[model samples]
Target: MTPASLVRRSETWNFDIDAYTNPYTPPSPLHRFPPWLSRFLGYRKEQKEDVGNVLGAVWSCVGTVLGLAVIAAVFNNTASIRAHNPPALIASFGASAVLEYNAIRSPLGQPRNALLGHTISAIVGVAITKLFQLSPHFESVKWVAGAVSCGTASALMLLTGTVHPPGGASAVLAATSPEIMAMGWYFVGLVVWGTTLMLGVGLGVNNVQRRFPLYWWTPVDLRELQRRRRRDGRADVENDVQPEKIVDVVREGEEKVSLGGIRIEAWGVEVPEDLVLSKEEAMLLEVLRERLRKRGDDGVLERVPSSRPSTDCTMVLSRSGRSGSDTEVLYSVT
Candidate 1:
């Protein structure tokens, strides 16, 4: 059977309302660093492409050295911080430098994860260690305290959507290391300070050739999503149409297809049946589709004369709520 014949809309498929809603929209003043420093920051939309792996590796090393050095210099030189018996530089930050510099693209390396993950883990670790210290044999069961703190921090990080791997080490260090435990709640402040310094260095180093963060708060444009929802809601009210009824209509119009056992929906992506994609690949396609949709909504994609032959299968995209006369050819399949 032909590919078209294999395609059908799945009525049972449900829309993810949460995907379009972002709690971080109009993010707090603390999270407004990117916009405030827009000139210095680099986002995915601003970059045409990434650097080569060799260049990327070089920058990674530079970032790691600079980030760690800055933190160490500040910690070691400061009279108050240096007074601590074992020094103030947390060991876990070494792991964090790898993520922040080498694996800059990872979600764990993002500002939210880097800041909140380490902070939250530090808090949990300190609290748990204090409780264990109340026991007379606290020294004997210190390893147990370390294990418990790490596991608890991991769970809390996952729940809060801030899963930084180094955070686990921070928690363990707080519970097991005598020096870190002596720092008490002060350990939390050091974690935050070190993370902040590393991120600052990353911003400068990574943006020299590549984007440091794909996004500040989230990958989705929360503000745009909110505007779309409001516009849709107003239209529904004027038409006296229930939201459920509108969803039903949309579902009826959507097409679903399966290619080599992989399900595809009306998200504007198409793949050959023989082709297979990893989860990351599929997510990347979806992000690109979202960007295109946003650009289309802004009426930035207008029709232009095509130099290619007419035999090409061209896909046209028009501004939302506009007619075919305003459509523009987005891509052509040869």
Candidate 2:
């Protein structure tokens, strides 16, 4: 294979962490539940549109109320927490409820973000505030401590890919609120408890009508992607595939060139000529194409019933000579 072809092949089939980390619809486990139970669970491969409708609005309100109420009840009624002068219920969770209930589809609303964001921010906030306390003039510069904690938490959240907006408030509260400061490291436990309770309620309530979390850890199934990559790698090594074979695969169908070397042909679907796609969108499409190609190679496509209507689509990625000229073709045989 030409150096360019080898690079293109590696890019196509190689396992990259970021590729599998991006959000995508994963297969739902709720299908295994009894039909009636599954209906109530509301797990789906596709998310329902979050349009403004009376039923959706009512469900959102219900989820918000239930989540907050559950947390409040636990914190307030618990004898140990009640003994403390100030209640353990933190204000930042009110903002979290907005995302978890109202903006259910948002990445910020997902479990990973909601839990880690609050916990990490709480830790940062408490640690910074404690350090400030050592200065003896903590009262004079407590606001500065709050600002520093919030800023540090923001950076940490971004780096961890768990950027929930409410997390910043949690950090600020930990530094500025006397009750939270008095709790010190114990505040971390309270944040965790509140966040866990909220997520628990979200799972039961939000899933009744619409999906609360689009994904738990990641939207893409990383385990399956890794398995496929390993299998493909083994096959490539065993076959000692030649460059000519790779070229032939790219040239299998009739060739048509397009701008940016992206050739998309669809039979039933209408694609706009002036369509502009972001890099992330292009990468996602590439991942979908890879999945289709893998299914075809495994004879999965051949097993489909022929009586059903289907469409033939092809996508070709070609690079110019200056950019290591090469072509990779993907076909969806349905």
Candidate 3:
């Protein structure tokens, strides 16, 4: 009765007899295919490398190389004292370099985060190891200490607004790695030194590319803010004059617009006293003049004597008849 009942229950559970006897399955035909061909044909979840990342890749490599070289040089040159171990470079520093160099635009990649997060994590890790007296022989003790250290490091970094993801790895290294554990609190100092070196490289390399640390502690640009405010103020005053009608003149590498005697200027483009507009810009100006002419009861486009003898593109346009009166408006579009 027991055997019969067991058999019935096993059948009810749908246990596979084949799985128990022979679980192994023959490899698929695809296994015989060339790897390159498979890669070309197979569906992949990962996206192709962005062409834009070429510059980033080059800079990251340079920064990583430079930063690590400096650290290695220091490590080699420094004399160690008896009974005290100088900080050896840790694996986490490699990860830190990736963020600091490769992903410099990230908040966690900033100098403050890289330095503080690693230092805090290393300290926490060392503290946990010492507090627990975690022995390598006892796997459970090591695991507990490592886990606690990692958790504390993460919490501290997050609270301090210095959440560098690699700091967790640093905690794990400090708590679990034999080399780091033996070095004791010396690991913290090492982390600081390494971080500083890497950060210096990152700053230099990233700035050279005209991008990096995208923000300091804050993303606010005070200069940009002030400029915006001033622009807004100017716009408010010109609001009655139809700010949209003010044509933005692009001349070579300058941006300037003159409307109602208010000159709006921006970087990378300047309007010279005698600027020659591009074909597209000239067409746009004509379109604007046409629109104004359509609105006017009487309008005529006439060339006038230029104050600058070299400038022949000066054109004067007069539109009359809002109230049956004539008004002369001087607009120079080159």
1 or 3, which is superior by lDDT? Answer: 1
Top candidate when judged by TM-score against the true structure: 1
**Runs with alpha carbons beyond 4 Å of true place in candidate 1:** 1-21, 27-39, 86-88, 235-334
lDDT of each: 0.71, 0.69, 0.63
Q: How accurate is candidate 1 locally (lDDT)?
A: 0.71
Measured on C-alpha atoms, candidate 2 has an lDDT of: 0.69
Model 2, span 1-334: residue lDDT tens: 8999998888766434445444243445766888666644445655557556687788889988998899989988888776664554689999999998888888998998999999999999999999999998999999999999999999888877788999999999988998888878888988898999999888888776676677776666655876777788865654453222211122223222233534321111112324434334444444444445566666554322222122222222333324554434222221
Give the TM-scores of the predictions, in the order they appear.
0.62, 0.61, 0.48
Cα lDDT tens digits for candidate 1, 1-334: 6665556444455554335437436632334466536534654334476788999999999999999999999998887777765454678999999998888888989998899999999999999999999999999998999999999999888877788999999999999888889989988988898899999999999988787776676767666777887888865644452212111111222233434533233434444334444433444444444454466566665433323233322223223334656553222122
Tell me the lDDT of model 3 at 287: 45
Q: Which lDDT value does model 1 have at 129? A: 94
TM-score, structure 2 vs. true: 0.61
